[model samples]
Target: MFADGAMVLGAAVLCGSASVVLGVLGVRLIDRRISGGGRAGMSASLDAPIQPMVFLFRDGTLVDATAPARALLDRIGPPDDDWGRLMRWIGPRIPVAREQMQQLARLGRLDLRGGEGQGAATLRLLAEDMGEGVARITLCDPQAEHAGIVVDSMSLQAMEEELGLLRTALDQTPMLIWRQDAQDRITWANAAYLRRAENRHHGALGWPLPRLLESPRPVPGAGTATRRAALEEHGQVSWYDVHSHRTGDQTMMFALPADAAVRAERSMRDFLQTLTKTFADLPIGLAIFDQRRNLQLFNPALIDLTRLPAGFLTARPTLFDFLDQLRELRMVPEPKDYRSWRQHMANLESAAATGHHVETWSLPSGQTYRVTGRPHPDGAVAFLFENITKEMTLTRKFRADLLLGTTVLDGLEDALLVFDSHGQIILHNEAYRAIWGEGEETLCATISAWEARIGAGPALAALRDALGRAFEDRPLSGAMAGPGDRLLGWTLTPLSGDRAMLRFRAVAGQPVPGRAELFEAVGDY
Candidate 1:
């Protein structure tokens, strides 16, 4: 234990001594550069030529650097490691420098010269290990201007050239870029910003240029924020997306023109309004759902048809929720139970997404509604609700009237059969069926078959010819031999709706209903 404590104590003392020596050497290097020379017989001008750039790093941290070296670091921007930027700048020119710098403790020193050319190629780098994990890097250029003892003119020239490049880039860019100080005062602006600001105000802007935008300035450490602002120029308002970034006590602002985006938004809004107006005037209820099955659009008719509350619809409920509302209102077809209703709703959404779906909703209130779901683009679905109650009522009444007419025709003692314009059998009375046989036999009976069944006399042949020709509007009568030689009277007459009726009766029954008598109302029976 005693020996371990002694070893630690000795190591701490050695580290403290190394730190002191390093600080003293740093001060001496700075002093020598500021003065005329460092080595004996070396003049300031001669030393400048040999050492155009110098950097001192201790434990991977930049302790000090010449003014020219500082300017070069700024051009490369921020880096996590202090020496990383310098290593990157020198790596391509002296590929071995990176590996050699890592092994600096073993190598002790390094001298590298680039190719004969301008920039990093024509450069020379000298590295010296100052022990205790400290290193000194010296960059030299024979062609660079280094007349001063303190600062290298070549570094100054590089800084000025870099500044010119940045200036030109900012001026050519179409966006507006400006800087604001701690008090939100405009401190700097690019050429694009100046041109717009001056044109808006109709005058030239001096130092600390005007703050054209009214957005709130970002505070230091706030990172970045973006919003929209407007600038009016000669009664014309122009919009822009303003981006603000704060660094320390100052804020940098940028503006990008947003006129095209704003205009497109307004146009879409207007188009929707027009469509809404058209839908509002339609009699059919309309409801549209997007791909997410959420009700995105609905019309006034939907509320009237479904009896749904306006608030629930405006809340943008899902498709099932809308149907649930209808179910509660008894507007939809009643399901056998809630379980089946849930399944039906699921199928409805699936079927609608795939293709069109139609359902006849018979409400408990005796109202009939036709609900149709049509698939639209982008997986959307449109529903149309139509009230078909009146049309349905008319159809039912027509069916009832036909049933009554058929009953009256069947009650007649004569056999009657009705034929359409196409000579196809459409209707026949019970008496006709009794005489012509029932079912398939009754359907097989034609005028010629009837003539053979009754005995083909001259009068029967004339009647058969009359029936075969184009049915005339006039009434025609004839006699034929009935079964067991019984005489039967037959008459053919035209009926309403492009139909013809042929009737057969016993020769003695009410004299076979005269032409005018056959047309008599059924009440006479």
Candidate 2:
């Protein structure tokens, strides 16, 4: 709709149309020219439309004038078609007596010369009569050049064509373009805007434009504004790069879709959520540093392990700042020389880049940590902290048990040997090894009981049989005669879990020959 109660024809004309106040008549004139002069009495041979320089109503009142006519006519007085007013406006140019001035409307041709030495302007009047003494008049000037006033038909055509192109562009462009009056009423909207708001209750023209959005608030001041418009229909938010400016009493706005950027942000948020879920259940404390060396991510274990304040972690401190906080918390090792701590951090970063950073930090609280740094993609670094104090303690206890067992066995007067379920020697003291003529090289190397009896003679066969029965989960005890009339008592004791221990004692009496002699020697021992 135009100002001052101007109405357009239909919805099609209004939907995506631009300012058409001055263009409607121009379009009609072009149509008349294209249709071979549709005017009833107009000549078909005319090359152009009949554009009147002045329009006169039936009551002899001035209606409108072309720009050139307006400019030239303003030199005299306000243009009025009243015969007396016309005579006064034209004044000396009429050359008719003041008494006969009323007949000027009936004149077929009027040679009107503007003020000064300008040539005369010839106005050809075409008068149409309506019933009951009313007439419509059109004034055309062929030789009109008042003060260099000239109309270029080609220029007007070019301008009209450009206006058409601009209107079409506004309607067809993907961007949402609209105009709103100072009262916030949506005066005009392009096709894109209408489509975007088609589902809304008050999306039509003449409605308040702010109602199209869930939260429609104007930007403060006279400058342009950029913001997103969250559509209420689907719970989907659309990002728009808005541009606004004032045109007289109206504010024009243009918005471009920024959906890709908005979606990317959403995707990043979801990815972080999944990553946080994964990191939450990890036993190892985890910390990730971004390209800027800022601590971007941390898990609950990290807070527990480092003993740093949760507030500090939430603030996204830089890597160096995080390390300094850890140092204050005594989570990491205290620096050898506190003055060069920063340099030490730099070294740590360098080593972490190559994935070689590993250290054990023994804190003052008697807790030990195995800290390692690894490089991730995109110039990021990840740190892992593991509490290894219990593991280290268990390993030390096991090593002490093995040492104490070995010392006790070494101090025994009796020779002892132990075999695993596979019938291979596992534990043998020096006494056992010496009795079997074995050396230190025999330890850990696989040796069967048969191999241990190589030079012990026939009685050793009985001892080997006892050892073999122990490997079969049976325990046995017997005595065997050794060299130089010596008697030895052997016992095979089956231990838990498919293992057995063998003990041998030197008999003090004479050599035992048979089972009876061996039993008597065992009784004596």
Candidate 3:
């Protein structure tokens, strides 16, 4: 009976140990299912086609993330060990979704959506309480569902193309072109800009724009803040007049002011030089004088004509010395009156106080000179001399031509009247005046009154009407004849804006026609 009792006790102990082992294993299996299965369910929901998800704990630890979230996270790198630290660093960098995350954390369960990736992605944050201090979060992405994208794309492309064309045009232009960033850094420059010695970067691409501008030479209008204001306010092109240093040439880039880029197509220097070169090269004895009666400058032609050494004509020569030299050379007539010569000197002094002075004289050699003296911007004086010998000859020839043409027209036995643009008589031969029973002066008055008297009839009225039409339409011409076929041929010729000429001729006995006939007669005569 003692042996039986010992065996029974051992069997009971073994059964009790087995029961405890099975119970412990069942609890462990249930825990594993809860943790792993819960995570899997959350992952499936986050990965839905229309949704982009990111999950974080209350402390900001990234627990789970979707494909789109993963892409953004890649750019920022993985979060740090401390969740709070991660949130603080990245929250401000992303403009969107930051506020949403903060709001969601405040509310136990929150749903919020926003933009990401330069408006390419949409982010959604959804959080739910999982009891006992746990939470699940989800994010969403929606970039494909938006309108106005096509219009935006086309507008952006057009703007980009226009900018590209503008850049190309500026680069090809002769003047230097450049742009600076807000920090005064040289962001871009063209070929002409790079060619400048100071602007060369020695294999480097860019330098500070302010450094380039800090040379001894002053930028025009730089003392004022106009250029800076224009850059900030308009963000459009602005101009600056610059005097830059050249590499080998000693001629400094003197004050070249340019317009806005589009208006800078023409070269101002070339135009000015072309206009002035001919005047500078004329063979005349010319000299520019200052207030002190001393020579300031003279052209090459003047120097050659006068044979005066350069050093002798500096800014301190006396007027008496100049005139004495001219008199000794017999270039000028002997002072017929010394008093008049003195008077001329006094007049020059008086004229300097008032304004410019002009005078003309003829030399014994039949050469004539017209001299004009004008004040300069720098308080100096400029003298312009023109040799009028050829002009005088031309004037004589013109007078002869005019007289000959008049004689021929008068001999033609036709009544001719030439009126100005306003139908006032400019010219009427003796025959025309006689036909109207008026003198030369009377003819002018009579023609003036005829316009008011006849209104719009044969002679004066027809000429006025034709001139009005020609003035309206450019290069217009028309003819009119009288009631009895008296042949009052009228013509209209435009002189300038709203101004025309009316010529009338009696077309009896091979009538002298319009202004064309007058010109032809002059040429033939």
Candidate 4:
């Protein structure tokens, strides 16, 4: 029994030993398989291109930058330096993107973005947590991304150049080109503006237009609150008279362009000059006055009519001097009795305090004048005077002449027909109407109307031509024949610039001496 038990124990020990060996071998095989897979993955990863990258740590330390990233860092100087110093080198040269990595050890995530640098390349930084309280960082270079931005910048520069050329063309135009700021300071003025009277200097930029007229003399409409309100609210075209001591003998009405607040300073002078010429050439007379009612300047028409000597009129002249002179010359017959004179003086006194006044006056020559006075932008007054004397005289003369010539049609025997340069009847005396067998009121309404009615035939055409020549100081006389060879005498005389007077008389039955000599003498007169 003991021997058999020993045999069983020995077999059991051998089998147990073999089983332990097999289990150890199998475990080794599995370990080799896992190691081989790991090696294969590592080899494949290593074979891939070693792309350049930038590694930024959670502690603000940057490392493992690729070759391009290293070059960018070198250009930007050390990253460990103070932010201000770093900015001094890199802020202007790079699209620096800043971001914080949250709990870098646990999150193991990195934010990547493009940044500016020399050569217009892009850089991206990556971060990863290694589970042992340490983190890994990586940076990548993206040259393609930055290339697009470079191309876009070049396109923008080209567009700006084209716009600059367009602006230059506009500046050279004849019209006054100008720009102003919100505060009305002249920012730009064109060359044409520099040639105008007050704007002879090319340096008009940074000057406030109102302040430019800083002379003691006031500018027209400048004192009005309404005008300033308009400028602020609507930015509409506003007209105002300005006088600059630099420009002698004239004050100009400037038409400020609408919404010109953003224009350049190079165009201001041209704008002002254009506005000046347009207003200066107007048919109406314009003048400027100071607070003391002294005349600064007057148009040529005003000068001729007032007969006032030039150069004596200045912004500081006294009002009493002007009125006293008119009285001394007896031009104003009853200067003391002229209510208008007193009213004007009162208005001026009131304007000195409140800033503006308007009035009218009649001269002793039975002429009427309309006067408008308003404060200028520079604290002065501008006066516009219109003479209605000729119209009034014509109205009075027509009334008197028509009343006296009511009768004696054919008996007086003086043929009278008033015709314009175009042979259009303006007025005809009773005898002329009787001879022509037409009513006086049937005369042509206009020169053109007469030409149309006269059929533009040779006789009427020659008559019109002769009338035009006579008005130009040329003598014109001709004989007209009726249907039965009846002789009619004609004479042409100029009445005004383009108007003429024509007369016809029967020469057949009367002793008609040659009046051509008389017409020639009158033409010389």
lDDT of each: 0.77, 0.65, 0.52, 0.52
Put down candidate 4 lDDT per residue, 18-48, tens digits, no spaces. Answer: 9999999999999999999999999887665
Which candidate leads in lDDT?
Answer: 1
State each model's C-alpha RMSD to the native. Answer: 19.9, 23.0, 25.9, 21.8
Question: Mind giving the per-residue lDDT tens digits that candidate 2 earns over 363-428?
Answer: 888888998999999989988989999998898899999999998886676778777677566777
How do all the candidates rank in terms of TM-score, highest first? 1, 2, 3, 4
Poorest 10 consecutive residues of model 1 by lDDT? 436-445
* Candidate 1 residue-wise lDDT at 164: 82
> Which pairs of residues have clashing backbones in candidate 1?
none
RMSD (CA, angstroms), candidate 2? 23.0
Better-scoring candidate (lDDT), 1 or 2: 1
User: Which residue runs does candidate 4 get wrong by more than 4 Å?
Assistant: 1-9, 12-65, 71-89, 92-272, 281-385, 405-525
Reference-based TM-score of each model: 0.62, 0.57, 0.33, 0.26
Model 1 stretches astray by more than 4 angstroms = 1-170, 179-188, 213-228, 243-254, 438-445, 448-460, 468-473, 482-486, 509-525
Best by TM-score: 1
Please identify model 3 stretches exceeding 4 Å from their true place: 1-286, 307-311, 314-316, 376-380, 420-424, 437-525
C-alpha lDDT of residue 135 in model 1:
96
User: Of 3 and 4, which scores higher on lDDT?
Assistant: 3
Please identify model 2 stretches exceeding 4 Å from their true place.
1-170, 177-190, 197-203, 207-229, 234-237, 241-254, 258-264, 274-283, 339-344, 356-358, 434-456, 479-487, 509-525
Determine which window of 10 residues in candidate 4 has minimal summed lDDT: 224-233
The stretch of ten residues in a row with the least summed lDDT in candidate 3 is: 224-233
